[model samples]
Target: MATHSSVAHANLTVRQTLLHQLFGDHHGWLFERLRARLGCPSDAADMASETFVQVVALDDPHSIREPRALLTTIAKRLMYASWRRRDLERAYLDALANEPEQFAPSAEQQVMAVEALIEIDRLLDGLSSRARAAFLYSQLDGMTYADIARELGVSAPRVHQYVVQGLRACFEART
Candidate 1:
């Protein structure tokens, strides 16, 4: 029933003029809210800008009715991503500190490891304690199945099964 031009116009997001006006009106308020929630002014400002990036990428950003709510929600997700990054960096630094100084990994390897750590962290959420421990021992500490079994007081095959369960969870998350 809709005309092609009407559908095309509907597909268009916020025009430049409206985008500028929206930023001028809402950016300061959004930054303040993010600052209060994040407890860091610099991080809050960065997240507010990222929120506008998210808005501009939206398919129907002009359809938003509650601008403050929408901005805050987007900024909150950016804040979480920032926190996740910091956590990954800290963990990577700790891992490096424990390694022999002569065996430093390449930057590419470090980046991939950190990303894998984040993915494993996400996948391990909601798993039982034993299952989580099995995966971490095998993946992070580089323990053999027999070693994990001894540490966990379970059979070696059980530890293997636990690791498989964790891997299956990660695979399911990807698909």
Candidate 2:
């Protein structure tokens, strides 16, 4: 019987071989497709590489019947995530720009803030737009339920429900 180490090595070898084949076959096509959409060669290269990295993490890379389609799906997700992160950073910077310089956070604090925002965004990803808005308004702005309801054009009770949903999402994300 194969030793456990040897079995693990075999699995690793299989994953590497599968990744090599997929990369060799799809990297160029994926790069060009991303480049055309993004209008940047470097970004396309990075996205393509990230797409392959996602594929490598799959439990059954050999089971893929539509390689290009899978690659496209993965790359699109990576692109969207990259865009979201950029948007978050831009919004954070815009908010910071409005603050007094004396009260400004350090560069490291800014980075940590952005990262926390991203985490919160991810935690709230399952929420509806209105629900997310309600949660942010309550948590970040300390808005009352009635005020959130007015802002969201919903009843105060409905706003309460949204806040509850958002809280559940955050709780679920933690576990």
lDDT of 2 by residue, 41-94 (tens): 999988988888888888889899999999999998888988999999999999
Assess each prediction's global lDDT (C-alpha) against the native: 0.85, 0.92
List the pairs of residues colliding in candidate 2.
none
Q: What TM-score quantifies how close candidate 2 is to the native fold?
A: 0.92
Alpha-carbon RMSD, each predicted model: 4.1, 1.7
Clashing pairs in 1: none
- TM-score (C-alpha) between model 1 and the true structure: 0.66
lDDT (Cα, tens digit) per residue for candidate 1, span 1-175: 9999887676553376667888999999998888888888988888888899988787766688988888878877777777887888897889898999888888898888888887777788768889889998998799999999999999999999899989888889989
